[model samples]
Target: MKLVKSQPWRNPDTVLAQLIQSCARTRNLDRGKQLHAHLVASGATPSTFVANHLISMYAKCGDLYHAIALFDRMPQRNLVTWTAMISSFSQNNKFGDALRTFSSMCAAGIKPTQFALSSAIQASAFFASLEFGKQMHCLSVKLGYDVELFVGSNLADMYSKCGSLVDACRVFDEMPDKDEVAWTAMIDGYTKNGSFEEAIVAFRDMLRGGTVVIDQHLLCSVLSACGGLKAGKLGRCLHSCVVKLGLESDTFIGNALVNMYAKAGDMESASSVVGMNSHGWNVVSCSSLIDGYVEMDQIEEASRAYISSRRQGIEPNEFTFSSMIKACASQAALEQGIQLHAQVMKTSFVRDLFVSSTLIDMYGKCGLLNSSIQVFDEIQHPSDISWNSIVGVFAQHGRGKEAVRALNRMISRGNKPNHITFVSLLMACSHAGLVEEGLEYFYSMNKTCDIEPREEHYACVIDMLGRAGRLEEAREFIAGMPFEPNAYGWCSLLGACRTHGEKELGELAAEKLMKLEPENSGIHILLSSIYASMGQWEDVKAVRKLMRDSRVKKLPGFSWVDVNNKTHMFGAEDWSHPQKEEIYEKLEELMVKIRKAGYVPFTGSMPCNLEESLKERLLHHHSERIAVAFALISMPATKPIIVKKNLRVCVDCHSAIKLISKVEGREIIVRDNARFHHFADGMCSCGDYW
Candidate 1:
């Protein structure tokens, strides 16, 4: 601009021309107007090409009105002028204006070029105007732009993106020489349109033609297709190819690599890949990692990964926060999760809906039901996510009555319940021992709401009946289900037999449970306990031998208690604590008080061959009771004692704890594997059924 401004003999017309070229390139509209004024003062009328450049520049700068005005003022227009305007509209996402401009250009008898055709076709795709796209295809053929490489590619891309695979393929086949981009577009279109078989065929065809055998983008897309089509073997083959091709360094490919392993049920390998690429922990990558950890129930590892992300200064986004919060709830990391909630507020995600939902779940799992309710209140207009999170919290924590109340309110507010919503409701009812309400919701799931019950929903119903002591009804429900019962299904019935001491049904259930889960020692222990409770020592010994033969190991029991905002965990009779001597002294005092209130040892479920005195040793030293002792000693005299157990508590502990809660005049809430047991006033929430 300064060069044009300083030279007087450079000629005003030539100088103004050079300045307009610079302004158009830089999109300096102010300088462009100054250049135009210089040209008009020199009595020079701008040419068609100059006017087109001005229009293109203004349109590129998002000044659509100025571009259209300049084009209308042009004394003569060419294909270049029309294409420049249409391309600007398409790029700005004003697809409707682009199409109308094309129509007007044609009405004025101006022929369009390959550039015009591509821009118009792409605009059709932007708007999903499939009919208009077809019209553009016809116009391109008549205008002799169909043979151009870019024109044909745009046509295929438009049809493919518009979800018309047939038209996209027709355009692809008509092309003279299809490039790699065309092939990739066609393959993606095939997959997006559910023609996965055709997609695989296209990939193979590209390979046979000596095209690039493997690239990061292509492999990532094809691996995702394998997951969608459930072709695990093919996905593994792709993984081998990716490794051999040395494209594993690509972050997108690496994330897909982890996801492919997890989806194929090879979580051990998935973690290996995730471990090698710590920097690959973006929102998508971390989400896949957390999901895999959750799938394998690797509770602690999930929390560690979340902590690692925070330490790396890669502030967790919504997906990372949502998935990590879910893992925290699963692992019962309630206290640590509270800090994450505060961090979420300081970050840019304070108003995020998914983040709010995850917080609801976190507080809910920790038995902070009121906190969960408060988070729900903050949601401006709660959607399914907010409803499901709060409802699932109650359901998982055994607050069945409250969960139903919330569901009714959600429906009243015109929020529809999804399959997961009903699953949580049934879980709540199962834990609450509400047999009639559980069955009613289960029946109405598919009939009224049109949400078909999955295996999990059916499992909840079986577990629901079992919790209510309707063992025969549970058996009947399994028999009447549309699909064959799964391990969870059989496990539900087996749990009932163990609690009710139904020898005939217990024996039948053990047989099925063994067949379904031959390697689950918990099921073997469950079977043995039922036999021992009924005084069938021979059957108990036989069940023990079966477990020994199978070589299945059970997870050790653990318990957690919160006191003065500090969580204390005890595993078994762990006696190495710094305050072990004082803890036992408090335990002894609690034991004597409960014993005077008619408490007796019920150790029929113990598997060890112990003397009469030793049986009571294992019963009283149970982890839940030990954690309760710690809670009672540390908290105020009448403060509610909250204990969380890793597994379902034995019947003896359940009854003894109820007496302890009454004697101490404290409300003790114990969350076990199945449901919460609120022991107050000498009553268990499960009514002794669990």
Candidate 2:
């Protein structure tokens, strides 16, 4: 539709402005310019409104230069033109330019409107520049924009994002009236910044005042923060809110409910939330269920959920791949992971960083390092996740030197390492007994990189120092921690104490461990063993009585191996297999042959239990013992035997495996919670560090 020109008016300025409006309404900047030229040629005085619209057209059409040029040429301008320029700069992410524009606008003797001030505040929020945001807030009130709801919301959000929730509340309360957006901004500010309790408080106030309705977005925000906390009471209370609102079947809320319950360790609640749905498995809901199952280590359940997700016609995204790959890694299900890899290749997300990195991690953990490396190389630009995954794979393989090489390569390529990168490096150093390297990296993590060390980082350092027999240093380090020592930190020291035969320190560390895990009998047993090793047999008897009295038993150790398309499982002293007799016969013969080749029994392992002779028998039928025997029978000689253990392999087993490695001239790789020990040619990669 063509814009009809307004009739010539008694006010020539008004007639020129009308013609300008007609040109602006046409959205033809060229025509507006031509009309402006005609007005200038006709010597008609320009009105502020005409100039403002001309500025708006320049700003709106992504022509900030023309906008600024027009504003400079105008004899008179209003706050609208200034607001338009500032907002345009911000919308283009020219934040510095926006700030400069605001400064210039102020210098031009025009007080900014709330629209301009709010736009500047939002830019501050994006950069987390609260000082600037605060200045804007002060100006807002001085300029009479503080009472505006949108302005207040922007200021509150900026304050909250800068970790100043108190000021955010001050601005929020200053508003005489608030809209849903204001309420959502305040609530989201708290929730996004991890202030869940405060969010709940504000939400409750909103409910009581009837200020706003809790929508699905608000519920998801609160529920995400609720996931890390064990708040079954609060979770159930939130469930009641959902029920009252009749939002139980809402896809997003249902997904959030699943995550909240799953993290609270209420699997029944989590399962019920997902089970109630027949075919409402949208991408968000499907991913949440998959995450819940993986977090619980129900790999098979996660797989079934993945299948159901595909059936529901919601295509999987990066998060879905992350969850499913983690499931296969935890289960060590290589075949299923391979199938998933094929599917990942077919998806449009094949090159996505998250999807590819998880795939690398899964394949690496599955002992397919070549596959992991291939995927890593295929990445156009690897993220820290990709680098960390490859490095972790090397560390897990007892390839500390290779891991360090990989890390160095990443750094050489200008890829900065994060906490995960440092973790993999520290782990590699610990496994390879590179004490000095671990120390250097630990110090560099904070001093050079400025990555504030978390408890896990400190725990790795403690474990490294302890494994290196620097017990005093480890104790001092723990004492110097800014935060209280956690279970992992103390547990690492405890493991070191046990390793280095520091019975006194071992007892002290056990005390800490016992406090952290009150019902844990393993720490008590380790303390008893340390005492008995030092000839305090009475204390050993006392610990035995305590364990029996507490009715706490040691966790059974199990091992599984795959060969000839069949999986074999072994438990400690397990003679349940039909071929047990034959297995024992072969073991007896191999032991005799190995002993003839200078192998001897290491009995220091037996005193953890009461009977010395029975302990020897138990060691003879231990899981690793059974696993090695099965390897000899099932696989050919000269092939390396890899065994993954649930816990650290015992000292006696370590020595026995070394003897076997030399006697049979075979390589055996044993992976446990602490590190990997590769026995080859009578040497273990740990170098007796274990």
Candidate 3:
């Protein structure tokens, strides 16, 4: 705004208006205020046109207070004046005020311009006010602005944000000319509303139309849909498109690409995207990588990513901490989880609902139920997720009664138990052998809670009955299921049959499992174990031969213990550890002591037809035993020995651990694939049920 220093301007008001527009464009609030003062001091009443620009300048400068004051003082306001004020409120996130102003404009018989209607529609979208949005749509139609590209695009956006995709699509289709913004709104709406398939279809249609130029925003929305569907092939195709479009350098596009690749389980591609991104990793990209690694059960990689992000000065937000904690939970890495918990406490996310719930779960899975309870108790206002996590903690620890009490408490706090709540509840009952209570809860899922029982709920019931040794009832329940029983149901029955030494039924369950999952090594292993328990060497040989013929390799069972912030893993009879001599010596010493305490090695299911001494030797050297031995040698006696296994603890090892705990006078907690076993005072927490 160069001043007219040479002579007085003939059209001073016009020059002032132009200067005010310049100030608004630059967001120069100080200059805008100076011009306002000049207008007041010149003793000339500015016309409505000039006044409108002043209002716009103030609004654009973010001085809403002055904008509103100026608006209130303006005795004559036209469409531009009202539009500027309404847009100001909308832009500043004063959504309710924007809508109110829109209403007042309507009451004043002021027909809104496209800009005003778009701002009001955006406000409605932010509020998710479908009814108000519909009214706005109607007004746009009545004012013959519905077909206007700007207003129609906003209408579609509002509908989508309100979760009314049908209406959004209708508006989008009725538009005379759909631009990139309109198509982007519809696609984004579908993606946001969980209609991933529909979103993809719309994106395809937009591309097929070929009239609208695709932009980064449109690509980002479609990529999100691909991620949701885990459509890796399509995601790769989009990656190629991004490269060709030269949008790969864009920060937002880079973040979206990382998220898509991560969600699609292509961590290699995801990591490359992060590396290739010119802007480098931010919290969003780093968190997505961590989450992807966790989902793939690569806890070590996830932890490394977390550490690398921190080293690069990227702070972990709630999602990052949550994913890392979840990774620790998956591996039962209690020490690492504890370290993450401390880190979370240092950040403001310690009290975040998702992070807190993840912390509770990590503690519970690591066999620290007390820590989980403490975390839950610290939550100021527990959400359903947090409540469910606490209940799940009790369930994981086999505390059925406490889980029920937690559920009651959750309900009392006005939080409804969702489907996840009942899953944990049913699991608790199953682990505790509360058969009747488990059945009651399973039935109550649909009757009382309005949550239709999913397949997982039915599987829990079967598991409950199977764990109670009610094989006949469990079979009947499966037979009576409305839908075909899934693999979990059959697996539960087979496990129970193996536990109770029911050879014929175990064989039958194995047959069903073979048809359902022909390559499942666990089924073959379980069946072979059942045959071995019955001393049927020929049948065991047959199963082993079938595994070899099908090329189905059994996953080797291993146990790992964290000592001094490092993990030591062991397999059955493993001699791979650097301290194998010490571990074995300690294990042999403990075995001798446990045997003195009347611990007899139970090798009924040792598959190999070997001498009694060799079988007993094999049983004594199971992976969990080796892990516990290592923990006892390396960890302090005051600390409980926590060993995590990839498979269920064998009955022989379970018995030996009970006696070892008593003889050594040290608590040993073994977390296997199924559940936790707290061995102390010559007893197990499962009471020998597991």
Candidate 4:
């Protein structure tokens, strides 16, 4: 095979093609061009074989311009030539051009090969064009290539990307030989479509079939399914598989493992996975851990994870910021929220719609309505979520009129109010005692917005009526519902009955609730409170006994206030704070001052059989009172106290806080499970309705 200078090998076409392929593999465009020049200077007309290799070499080197130039000048094109050009176009993501070339090849009576068909199907997959993909499938069937391994895999992938998992499965089943490519496509498709159970089953089938080899990609898809189903055991098994295959060091595999463990609520395992891959700790892994902590209600851990990620030089993405902000909102941590807002301002994500919407929600939940409004105003073209955030902010602050105004503005701006928008709006009316307006919106759900009232909507209406002391009307509304009332509906009714002291109806509602949620401690507690309020000691005793027999324990109530980026929690008569003595002294002093200013204890909120003085004392030491006292002693005078409670604010504490606000000349914002109460100058934002 030696070449001579006087006479180059008689047929050097094969050698030239080999040299061109080597250049293509190395992506050496200059060397490939030199080879082309050498071929031209040798006084030889390049064969079709040599020319196709040159075209492919230019394409692999990312010189599509040269590739197309060579292609256009080819005198006689073969099937291999057309396939190479189509593959080059597809590989370069010139999908439209690739499809057009395929069509032109067919028009020129050049039948397609399996490689060409695969490339064409790939282009259709990118476009998610099911109709065009079906046409390609029909063509493959006509050419008797449908059962070819490569062609079948591409068709399956195309159908899956088009969201037609049914067709994908059909094509996959018809494949004579299922490879890893075909199996991965089917399993990944199931996961992406939220058919998590189907995905798990398919993975099991693939394993039991013992045909396709297990790989990181297949394991990643299965792990995602396990996460979606919260099947921690299955995820762990997949983790074992990943380790055995030595794929744990792979970046994608690492991220998938972290995400799977996070979704499974195994934060410790998620953290370990992150630690194992410290060098590859990316935003995806960090965000997943933070989001997991947030989901588990561990805001502190979530915050710490975010800080650690930043210290490790992992920049926070929009999702990381959103989850952290949501955690801040959940805890009413204003100082931390402010810090995060400043951080957001320095990043390009400040203009991100998702981040902006989350910022608005955080400010609103932190009792910074003005800041929420400002964030909303800053959005040039606010999305429906942003508008909903503003409306919800108004709703949280008991500004029903303002919420309605925001809704009107949203409509004027051509943003259609979705179910979430109306939920906030209805809750606003309920909190503000705008019962008639709430009913109007409820009716308009179907007539105007074409949204049928869901269970939550019906529950909101019942709450509105209940808040307005219209218990009978609330009951009638529940009865008139299209379906039987769910637990939420009955619970709303029962709470309203308790509020209005309708003991008989409260018992009926409690009965229904017990059947629906027999182990719910709140139902028993609310029913007992109803009996206690009516001075039915014997009935209260019976309800307590029933709770004991059923083993339903009441969840303890606690309130937390954030000051200087630190959260201080308080329970009833809490003595756990480092400055508990000062907090108690401040509480006594405030109680005295409010009493002198005509603040009388509302002992009715106690709901217990006790002496009047004891009831009053117990009422005075509620968690919110202790938290407020701590805030008053610890925070600066200029700063408003924002408290978050795990339960509803009782009437006695509400009244005392109102008088305390007047006595101390301080604004107190308290967020309970139900709504926000802005206590200032002896008045609450709910107008004494909630």
Q: Give all candidates' CA lDDT scores.
A: 0.79, 0.78, 0.89, 0.88
lDDT tens readout by residue for model 2, 237-329: 888888898888787788888878877767778777877875346777678778888987776788888898788777899889888988877
- TM-score winner, 1 or 3: 3
Mind giving the per-residue lDDT tens digits that candidate 3 earns over 482-517? 996678877888888888888887888899899999
Give TM-scores for every candidate, taking all chains together and pairing residue i with residue i: 0.76, 0.74, 0.91, 0.84
Badly placed stretches (over 4 Å) of model 4 are: 1-11, 26-178, 277-280, 380-391, 401-422, 440-452, 482-484, 514-520, 554-556, 575-600, 658-667, 673-689
Give RMSD to native, each candidate: 6.1, 7.2, 3.1, 4.3
lDDT of 4: 0.88
Name the candidate, 3 or 4, with the larger lDDT value: 3
Stretches of model 3 off by over 4 angstroms after superposition: 1-14, 100-114, 129-148, 170-176, 576-582, 592-598, 658-667, 673-687
Model 1 pairs whose backbones collide: none
Task: List candidate 1 stretches off by more than 4 Å.
Answer: 1-216, 223-312, 409-414, 560-569, 593-600, 608-613, 635-646, 657-688
